[model samples]
Target: MTNKLTVKIWRGKEQGDFVSYEVPRLASQTVLDVVTYVQRNLEPSLGYRFACRVGMCGSCAMTVNGVARWTCRTHVSKVVGEGQLEIAPLANLPVVKDLVTDMSEFFDKWARAKGSFKGKRTRADDFEPVKPDSRERKAADAGVECIGCGVCYASCDVVSSRPDYLGPAALNRAWTLVNDVRDTQQRERLRAVAGDAGCHACHTQGSCTVHCPKQISPTAGIAGLKRVVGRAAVRGRL
Candidate 1:
């Protein structure tokens, strides 16, 4: 373990600077560990947000070493170079504080994309048997594990350029539902994600897929939506 390490962290809201902090490096320390050390020991006033330290929560995502990643799962030894690191809040969103970004817009885009599942079943009805091997189920399965970490949203260049864009994550969520056999909102979901602010806006830069810590390809999902919605529009369902 290196006894000392230099960490440069973004230390302001929408208009601030990255401040450097010298930290004692420990064996197998993750980037979140380094930020915690600084917040606890060096600067109590520093701001960041996290819940579960494990990768499941997806709350500790930040731009570390010029890449958007889940800091809790990002090991310092793997990402750090030349004994220095740069950490900042997720890009393409309004910064709340130091390393904390405002996620309201990101989550709100999910609503705009009609990402919610509209179930057709009632409690009195029999259980719906969905085969895991079925094509729709399998397609939905591919993107169901997103933890809403905003990594894809932050990495997307489209979101940076177009504020009204529904973003990859939200469009991805809509894709999952569009493939669900039990979801009754297929036509509505397609309509919601069909227009300019929806899946059509994706340039397919693939930054979202590259930065997703969960390995979910939001780019692929958004592409799927475009195809499905395009067909619907051609079929006059729009």
Candidate 2:
């Protein structure tokens, strides 16, 4: 095995090109480690975002060899091609600098999708009991673990074609909220995800599911949203 790896990293903002660097290859080294090495040793000016390097924060997501992944958990050995690596900011989002894309649009779409829960009970009320075995609870539990990572968003091809598309993460969050029995905004949330740029716009490419580091199936969530919205529309309640 070679002791060194060639890395081509995107430099500057959205307008810049890839810059090549030679980095040391080590045992069990991750892609984030390589980028960190380059920034700390070779080029201190290199800009990137990372927190909770163990992979929980999902802030270190990037495009590795044309695929979106969580660099914190992506092993260099698994992704190295011909002893080389290419790292860039997540796609489909505005680039802030090098490797850090603006996340405002992503969160904004989440809000537009009505991803937050609006409980019917007041703060003075007692805690609501949710049956663990109930279908609604199960469905909600299935997708409640999303960490707002952009991996699914970046991997979505529909976002590339339709810039206004609400994207997968937002739809997935909406689905989770729709299943929450305690939520009082189901009608509005369903309507929010039913528009042209909403769940109806998804092409079901499953790219979001394929690349999600959290293994959350935004495609499945979008499908569920489609069914709910369709039923509501058929009932003339949408």
lDDT for 33 in candidate 2 is 97
lDDT of 2: 0.93
Write one digit per residue (lDDT tens) for candidate 2, span 52-98: 99989999999999999999899999999999999999999999999
User: lDDT per residue, candidate 1, 57-126, as tens digits?
Assistant: 9999999988899999999999999999999999998999999999999999899888887887899999
Residue 168: error of model 1 in Å? Answer: 0.6
User: Number of the top candidate by lDDT?
Assistant: 2
Backbone clashes, candidate 1: 0
**Candidate 2, position 72, lDDT:** 89
TM-score per prediction, in order, is: 0.97, 0.98
- Cα deviation at 146, candidate 1, in Å, is 0.7
Give every collision pair in model 1. Answer: none
Give the whole-model CA lDDT for all candidates, comma-separated.
0.91, 0.93
User: Model 2, residue 183: what's the lDDT?
Assistant: 93
Clash-forming residue pairs, model 2: none
